[model samples]
Target: MKGFVKNYSGIIWLLTGIALGSIAGLIFGKKVEVLKPIGDIFLNLLFTAVIPLVFFAISSAIANIKPSDKLSRMMGFTAIVFLATVLISAILTIVAVKIFPIHEALGNAQLSEKIEDSPFAEQLTKLFTTTEFYELLSRKSMLAMIIFSIMIGFAALKAGKAADQFVGFLHSGNEVFKGVFILIMKAGPIGLGAYFAYQVGVFGPQLFGTYAKSLGLYYGFGAFYFVVMFSVYAFVAGGIKGIRRYWKNNLIPSATAVGTCSSIAVIPSNLDAAKKMGIPEYIANVTIPLGATLHKDGSSISSIVKMAVVFALFGKGFDTADAIVLALGMTVLVSVVEGGIPNGGYVGELLFISAYGLPIEALPPAMIIGTLVDPMATLLNATGDTVASMVVTRFTEGRQWIDKAI
Candidate 1:
């Protein structure tokens, strides 16, 4: 039994969960929904551990990066890659709209009462929102903590020897939490099975109509972006061989992202992949998590698509200027107060409405798009995070990271 579990633990446990949960959900539906707490327990555990896990991992990664010309280049290159992916996504969104256009304006959308849009300054400040240390620890503010962690990392680098003890403590904590995360993953089949079962049971039928068409575009764009963007980044970094090697290694994170539907959920998997690929811990630790927090290519694509759908439904005409605003809005909104859990910062969709001057009624349907696209968007986001890290590592170190395990 031990040998069999060891041989196929990750795949077997999780897959069994999915299959069983889905079957049960199909048969019993809302009745089996009672088990949602089983899945919630695992998810909540991960969510709680991730705050500190990401903080220390990112801080240590940055601090340990020796100051040099390459470090400067790495920062610059990372930004370029991050923005490039998003910009490319914006472009693809135009194509996706043309290919799979949302013809009907949001007809069924109801006005939302909870329309709390933040100031641009407030949104930007949220990234480094350390004024209230407790707020930074919150789930909605993970990206904010990431910014603070990077700052701490730079300080540790300057402290050099004096910061060793502090840095070592962070390093130790990183390892410990990773182990805890693995232990938690053992329960993933149980938890995720229940979650997936309930989800499919409830929402599964919606996939057949208008929802399916839009979702197809969302997921279709994700696949196109991964193949093209990751391939392009890999080719530039290494070559055809590098692209081949990269695709070979990224299957797990790709699946995990699609399965989990949360970029934050796949951090441990990305870190593990980076380790097996022989990526430097400093580069992997910083880029993987930071990318999870910030580089939201999939979300960007979803935002653009949602914007197009809303504009079409409203019978609004879009000039190149409106398209540009959408591009910039998505980039900025996702960069700061990204849409997801902890704080429910749907600022990106809010930006969509505000930037284009759409009526309040559009938000309900726009939000519906956001919900359906989460998993597909997350998969692309996770895959891009690792690929972007690889590109950064190559340019900084002057060689591609050949997947040693491959």
Candidate 2:
């Protein structure tokens, strides 16, 4: 029963979130604005943990690799898999946006009136220059922090005895973060429930239909992308047999991620599933957990797709160089650096929008569409972590290690 519960907990949470969201939506239909603060609090909680969580996890993972050469190979493989997944997901999202263009214009006369009255443009400029600077300073931007931490961690690894001590400290710190993360995850359902309720209450039934086409496109592409990627991963990992057990075991984590829309919360289940795959405990501990911080295939893909949609909506074309940079930068920024915090989806998108000086008014529409697509993005993310765990385990501990463990 305990094992069964663990395996299906994600599904449970997802259903709970949906049910609660519906109830909240109905009850608070006219008071959605009041519930916005609750959503904001949840988002803040998720974001607050991201920087430290990522720094320690990645540093510790890198520090634990035995042979330096093996670490290099693992990093290389991780990079390739991460990049490939992001690119593929982005392409699928872009295609989907093009095929199913959401052209429904805003009919709210008051919306333009409100926009004109608001000082949002001035605030946005301030946010772009000042707030963004602070974000960079505090390592709020995942990409910058990731680059800094990786360089620092690598340097520490090479610093002989001093580095060893520091790395050990980071490993210990990573454990502390893990403990905090666990506590937060245990509270996830309630927090998510509140958020969903707020969303439903605020948007009402009418808004759902308004955003339906865009949302549908996002979800449709997300699903298709996940299916294709999962198939490829299974094939590469040695056919159905190697991946069969994993597929069966992925239910809880995948469901949890989908329901919560929070990848970080599913780390424990991901680690458990990786262990069940005959991945060595040492490898699983490092890779599965670390992957949670950096392996955001879904988020990266979704961001690209969202960006393309935004561009299309505005009748703009992506500059080739800019697109490449944005795609790669966002992949690293949001995944390897930011860590998989809840509401990270919003933060990452915001970072991209602000970094490139994109219009702020476009965000609301993009978010509405993106949320619908998010579940698939999260599913792909969890699947990527599972596949990455196998790849890293095989490379680090060797094929013989996996065979022997099995």
Highest TM-score against the true fold, candidate: 2
Model 2, residue pairs in steric clash: 10-256, 25-201
Which has the greatest lDDT? 1
Clashes of each: 1, 2
Q: Write the per-residue lDDT of candidate 2 for residues 1-406, one digit (tens) a residue.
A: 6755664475467457646765878876856556556555654554566567767766776666566564676667666766666666666665565566553342321112221111435533433344343564442245555555677778777786767778889889888876765666555556556665665565455445545655666667667666676766755664565567567777888877766555666788888887777776766666666667677777776676666555544444543554555555565565654463334565566556544445444444455445556667767776678877676655566556445755
Error of 1 at 310 (Å): 1.1
Q: What C-alpha lDDT does candidate 2 achieve relative to the native structure?
A: 0.60
For model 2, the stretches where C-alpha displacement exceeds 4 angstroms are 1-72, 101-210, 313-315, 319-325, 340-342, 370-374, 394-406
**TM-score of candidate 2 relative to the true fold:** 0.60
- The weakest ten consecutive residues by lDDT in model 1 span 336-345
> Distance from true position, residue 198, model 2, in Å?
18
lDDT of 1 by residue, 178-283 (tens): 6765676667678777876765565453322455567777787778787887799878766776787678789999887866666887899999887766667878
Q: What's model 1's lDDT at 31?
A: 81
Alpha-carbon shift of residue 59 in model 2 (angstroms): 11
Work out how many backbone clashes candidate 2 has: 2
